[model samples]
Target: MVRRRHTGRRLRSDESGFTLAELLVAMMIISGVLLGLMAVQTSALVTTAQTRQRAQGTAVANQVMEQMRALPWASLSKGMHASFASAAGGDPNVTSSQLHPVADPSITEPLVTSTDQTTDRAPLSGAGGSNKTVEADPSIPGFTYTSRAYVTRSAQTAANVLTLTVITSWRANQTTTQKHVILRSQAFAPTGGCGDASNQPYLGACQALLSGDAGATGPTVTVAAAGAGPTGPVTTPTTPIIPGTEATVATLSVGTAGVGLTSQQATAVEATATHGGLQTLTADAAVAAVATGGGRLTNSASNDAGSAGAAPANPADVTGVGSASPLTVSGTGMSLQLVPASGTSANLRATTTVSCATGVPAGQACAASDLTGGGASSVVLTTGGTPFTVASVAGGGSAKTLGARFTSAAGTTAVGCAALSGPGCLGTSVKRTVGLTSVGQGPWTGGAAPSGLASVTSYTDATLVERGLSQRTTAGVTTRTGTVSYWNGSGYSTLTIDRLTSTTLVTPAVTTTVGGVTVSASATVTVTPAMSIASHPDPVGCSGQGCSVTSDTGTLTLTVTYVVTSGGIPSAFTAAASVGSGRASAAFKAAPSA
Candidate 1:
């Protein structure tokens, strides 16, 4: 078969092989195909390495962001992880302006700044370690990466929101461009920018607290010491502090005091002892007392003393100290002065009885056992070796009061309210008797009349008069009044005066002819406006323990003039007096003797 195939196929020499140019072209084509494959593989390898590095860089950025997120509002500042290591939250009393790291208090807006990177170390593993730069690492296996994190406060999102950004950079090769991976996140500050109250008084903000529920928490709130008064620092837990039921939030030491708490809802405020300390509460029932009697949180030592001067022989007509004749008076005069022998601040006392609530049964009344006394009576004041007895009342919810009844040194004549009640001293009618002396006497006319008795005179004489001490208990308040008067033959000349209400009295000038003598008199009085205190709940926040009472404020003032014209001559006497103003607060301590 082989011999037969050879005999049939005889070819020319030209067809057996190719030309040299063609051969060269074929070789070139093969070489190009192989090179293309090699190039594609190389490109793929490079791409994979780049993707891995990017993932690592992104992870580093994420780590930095998380670190910043864990920090509190106060600690997450320009510093990195260890720069501001404090765990303290924002101080409520300290505003952002006051607390910023920089001295610029006006910087209210947030600024974007690079975090401190000096203390941070690269987390990547490399033989060159900390000493190598990304560009210096050969083979790119030891490429060093650098990370930077920036924090910015974004008001557009929220006042307390912070935007965190992290950028991780590295170089693929010595001549390659820098590549970076960025990651962003956000964190929120506590509501109201408040932190734990244990730090300091931050009541200015974060005043409201979260309700008391299981697993519930809120920022700490503090009551700071400020102003002139008995003041002490008070800090409370995050939970709501039930006044009286819980521990005291603050204590005012004996000699110190605190200013009013601004803008608080019904909250309990307290003072340990009485002194000149005054704690005024601002806002609706914001300043409340935990003491039993709705008493003020203050203290004082001196009683209401008239403008410094000597008292008349029978001042205020309360003490029957003057002689029988109005012309020549010599005896111990009425002195409205109280000096506590022990020099203690235990002066005023009170007792309260609440009425039936609005929704109580029609026939049922409040019980006597419901009486709540401010304190047991003690020695409050003494004058002329005789201590004045304080008066007590019952069954006045808010108008109940304690007062003193003045009597002569011999205990003969007395001037003052008989008893204290919500309706005022119900059974008492205060009367002042003044014995006046005849001035500029006129000769008796031939018949039944004195000479010059019909003449009239006018004068606006200004003179300092003796302070008259008068106490009137009306509508649960005890007002001390000073009156100007002169001694008459038998008693004070009766004058026309009207008391329209507990707060108003009308006294008009008058001229009268009695027994051939013309006498003209005029009197003036000043009263401070009544304090309109709103009704509030006991123990604050409607704790339902009982109702609370309000304290009272009062002033004393009076002016009087009396003139007599006889025998065409005129003699005038004027009296002007003012007693110091005082306030009566609820008493929770021992009451002085009544």
Candidate 2:
């Protein structure tokens, strides 16, 4: 194709594609929109990260709550706790300061996380940094959660009711600011159980509670209702109603009076004398009667004076609050006196007239009477495991038979018996006395017998006897020699047996103190010198031919006496033994004629 020449011309604004200034303005607008979109996307990503961390915090809080629930009642102490050390430093066993309180309005809430990387001087980029947790978000490298717990007991229910609060916190994107979640729960521990010290009064009390029903009704109430009327009732008989005759009255009577107003002195005096020409008499009249009846008496009279059944002019105004009336009685010469019982003390005395079986001269005192009909009404027991001691004699001079009580030694450990108590319940202590242990001798050995007599042989015989206490030992030895004889067809055959015995006593005697009482044990033993033949000729006599000798044996007796003394009382025991009880007999048998 051929080229053609064209001339240049100006175009309209609508026809022009673009200008440098317009292009710049348009580029700036497009860049602005793109940057705004990018900013929104970045914000969305951060929000998603924060939400994920919040979710993790919630899970961590729940996990801490579960841990608190797993702890037994005995291990849980009151106050805040954390897996790591707390910011508000204190005894970690009590309260922790690891997760510190939040900022500003929510400062009361302890929401600070352990891995708040910004709080420290250096960046908490590594897992080894302080306040870092192993439970870090694997996807979000440096993010971690911190968990804490608090425990408290109810005022009304005490340790039986426990409340637990768990908190979990974490830093948002490794910043100083933290987010957290809280959870609260409660735990219960049964009261009056075997572990409680108050529930145990003795071995029996704790044991009984182990098998007792905590919800059981009162003992007097026959049936247990949904809502009982009282916690503990003395007596509320539903069946077999109590009769009025058998029922007890609130107030007791003194003699014939409905009230306890009669004085002891007034009653005793009235029984012994007459007053004012009337058969009934008062205390003053009784004193006068005693004076007239050849018995000297001194009177102490005030309110009633010498009048019988007379009321005082100004009687005690007991009706008014905190009012009192004073009556004074003073005298020196008196034949008899009576005293009332008081706090921490008691006294009683009486004397009876004596009529001698045989006549006695005047002005001479009668023979002293023998006391009788008196014995211990009750016994007081002390705490178990106290060692027994002689202390002092309970019965005074005249007592022939005395009583004593014993208990286990001190530091004695208590044990449990399935037969007496339920599982985990302790039983009473087991006590045993140390006593005589053994009496024995050493073994016998064979040896040569005495020679000189034809066909005579001897063997050593040994005997032993010994006695000892629990903490002692003993030894002994004895010996005897004897001859055994047997008859053949032609003559008598004899075997001389000898015994040499020896024994050593380890402990001849021993003494020890038990409960302030001296105890001693000793042993004495002796052996009989004479030996007796225990068995004789078994084949009878030799029959018309040769006779052969056989083994023979003799026996001796050993007597032993053991003595033990305790608290000046001595006890004796005896024992005996026979030596060479089982052995061959000294006998000859006749051979068959050839």
Candidate 3:
């Protein structure tokens, strides 16, 4: 039983808790392990924060570098300062101030600020203090960042190398850390004796070189001089080079193996030596003395009659010598004349020889044969009406004949007119025969009529009369006097009838009595008789030959005498008549045989 108990106890003890020292030892070991893990986590968090701070600092440094690069190179020179504000939510109470270089280091230093110090202290907020706040906001705390840039010059012995160093610093997480970046650049500087120092427009790099700075170097250069001595040690004398001048002068050594100055600098040195001679020098006068040529000049003045001298007849000819006693001169006068020789003739004659086959007349029709006179001696018509004298005659031909009625002027006659048919006169006073009365009249009935005339009862009469008498009546007789008298107690008859003659037949009468009661009438007659008729034969009836013959019809015109009569007396008769159709009858009269 005891052994069973012991076994049970052993088992119990095997499953039971440890002793005090053993538990203490285990607790110590666990504590060491937890402590080591906590340390590792803490270190990781701090390293991450530091890395973040370093990245922010690098960003700030880049911003500064960009700003400097963007500025004009002149503004980036020494003693130039600038201020910048932080971005939003980015240290509102802090500011950065730049400290521009003024001396050899040629550096720019930037300072950052803290919020509390910058807001509370006015004097401490100036650019000299890094805590100065460019933008102040109460809600957020701010910290300042600062940077400084330094130029590293090349070694005086080396001409091709340049170096620069930049240092950036910031405060974060209660600690200050810094970053440094280095840059190197290179360029060529002018060498040889040909460089002119005065010709160097940009003096920054050169000045830096001469002053032993050698930072941010530029292009190369050489030196030359207008008048330079041979290689030797040259000494500047104590006495003034140009007397009585206050200008400062110096002598510089130029050698074959050592440093030398540019040509422009040598010129300046020489000019400085000479400038000591003059007290007050004018550039214009000095330049003018060396220039060439003077300009042409003239002068004019107006004069009046009463001003100073007497007036002359011609202003242009008012010379010192009088015109009446003109001075003898070799040149010819203005109005010289020369006459031609006395026996020389002034006329000029031109003869043009023409070949003619025949002689032609003036104003006459001509043919090609008329122009075939071969070499006839015809005188040419002159423009001035001077007769042309024929010098000689040769190769004469027969003269062409002209019209009989044509003639020419006396000098040397030529044909003037041509024989050609023209208009001719038909002759005056063409007479035409016409019958005065018709032979057969209508059958007369119960009326007294002449033997050969019929008592035409159906005759229509158109009569007209002029009541003036050509003769004047006196006592009981009619006389050829100008005055006309009416019958009163003067024994002059009121009515009288005379036998009708051609002159007394003014009141042409047509008498036709129906029952013989003296039906006598007078008429102003317009007589038109047919002088000629133009005939056209009509086609025969449509039958064989020997059918009834058709008469030829024609147009007839009449020429008749018209008389104006009045008061049963003759007055005047007109030679021409106004006659038309139906005023008389269209009697068919047989045409006369040809």
Best by lDDT: 1
Candidate 3 error regions (>4 Å): 1-13, 77-140, 149-165, 176-594
Cα RMSD, each candidate: 34.2, 41.4, 63.6
Q: Which stretches of candidate 1 lie over 4 Å from their true place?
A: 1-9, 12-17, 77-140, 192-594
lDDT of each: 0.28, 0.27, 0.21
Query: How do the residues 1-594 of candidate 2 rate in per-residue lDDT, one tens digit apiece?
Result: 999867877788889887899999999999999999999999999999888888888887777676555432323422322322434332222314322333222223232223332222111112222222336777876777765455554444454555666656777888888676767666554554433544222112222111100000000001000111233123332110111111111110000000001111111100000110001112233333111111111111122344576433222211110111111111111010111101111011111122111222221111111111111111111111121110010111110000000011111111111121112111111011111111211110121111100111232332221111110111122233544322221333444444432221212333344343332222222222322232222223222211221111223332222222333444322222222221111111121111
Local distance difference test, candidate 1:
0.28
lDDT agreement of model 3 with the native? 0.21
Residue by residue across 1-594, what tens digits does model 1's lDDT show?
455435566688977888899999999999999999999999998888888777766766677566555433444433232221221122121243222222233324344432333332222111212211122233366676765544556556776566665556777643477776666676554444543343222321222211100000000111211111123123234211211122222111111111111011111111112221112122224445332111223211111133244222111111111011001111121111111111112222111111112211222111110111111111111222332211111111111111211111111112123332221111111111111111112221222112111111110010000001121211223322223222232223322222211332324444545444454444444445323222233222222121212222333233344444444344333333222222222211110110
Q: Order the numbered candidates by lDDT, best leading.
A: 1, 2, 3
Better of 1 and 2 by TM-score: 2
* lDDT comparison, 2 vs 3, better candidate: 2
- lDDT tens digits by residue: candidate 3, 1-594: 355434433456577778899999999999999999999999998888777766665665565454433322222222121222322122222223433332223444343223322221111223432222222112225754554432223445254222222335555555554333222222232342113243132222221110000000000001011111233123133222122222112111000000000111110000000000001121233322111111111111111223454222112211110011111111111110111001111111111111111233322111111101112111111111122110111211111111111112110122211222111000000001111211111112333122212110111111100000110010111111111112122222222211111121122233332322212222222222222111212112111111111111111211111111122222111111111111100011111110
TM-score of 3: 0.21
Tell me the RMSD of model 1 versus the true structure: 34.2
